[model samples]
Target: MTMLNQMKKSLGLLLLCTVLESHADVLIDVTATMVDPACNIRSENSSSPLAIDFNIINSSELNKSAVVKDFSLYISDCNFSKSLAMVLNPKGGSTLSYNGKNILATSIDGLGIDFTEVTGGTIRALEMNKKQRIYPERVNATLYRMDLQAQLVSAVPIKQLELGEFTSTVTLSVTYN
Candidate 1:
């Protein structure tokens, strides 16, 4: 080939190679989830599961508002100042009341357990899987106290409630942001 044609082809090939070398075929992106540290939770500073015994609940006492017991839970060992939320999840299935309230169903038929939170001297019913901000009795590095009340609720009339030993379970989950 002529000298000028050969020089032109070489220059074009070098330019193409330069362009191809400067371009990237694969790109890498780094990603991560930056999450705040989690806090510890316990039932009154004990590692065991919390249990409430409603001893000898009479069938006539089963109603929408018959309280079985009141209890407290504690959260501690938190290093973050961010807000914390909690969820009350029933282990088995929950019963829906006639008034459209969610109640934790017991082993007995038509009878379930309901929970309420006592905050600022006002009582509020707690719903299943609903996130609630933890208004700690005192926010600090130490223990935080949370009060809860359990009530015996029946889907049917009190007379229709099964008369025998009954038991129920609830799982509490905590999250912080």
Candidate 2:
């Protein structure tokens, strides 16, 4: 009986060794992107939820010329970066794309708003997620003032303009390199 038990133990050990030997080696590829930390974003007035009031827009005036309002964003405490961009995403997924332009749709029907980024005398219309260059060149400054403008645009014919109190909300996000 002792001899038989010893044989069974030896056989079990051999099977365990064979099972261990059957294991295969695995190679894994690891990757990661090193992103610069985000900077502090604030309204030009150093307040939350930057707002621009297009006070008392005359519906009839939209046909004469687009109503324009200027606003600013104050950026500070930013990590050293070579460049940065501001991405505009209007809330509620409201937007109007007309004639090769993207406009932010407002609460009022037939009315929309267009945005332009002003950088050092150069003004360019901002496209959705186009990553428009907020920094013309590499910058290391800790404080920055980003100037912008909002222009009232009509999605429908001027005759179809809606009259009432209106509101619009857009979330501004920053990406840095």
**Model 1, range 67-144, lDDT digits (tens) per residue?**
568888787766446687778888865655645867788887787777888845677778777887766677555878
Clashing pairs in model 1? none
lDDT, model 1, position 151:
77
The 10-residue segment of model 2 with minimum total lDDT is 132-141
* Superposition-based RMSD of candidate 1 using all C-alpha atoms, in angstroms: 4.2
Model 1 earns a TM-score of 0.74
Per-residue C-alpha lDDT of model 2 across residues 87-128, encoded as one tens digit per residue: 888888788885587778889886888998875668988865
Q: Quick one: best lDDT, which candidate?
A: 2
The TM-scores, one per candidate, come to: 0.74, 0.74
Model 1 local distance difference test score: 0.75
Quote model 2's TM-score: 0.74
What overall lDDT goes with each candidate model? 0.75, 0.78
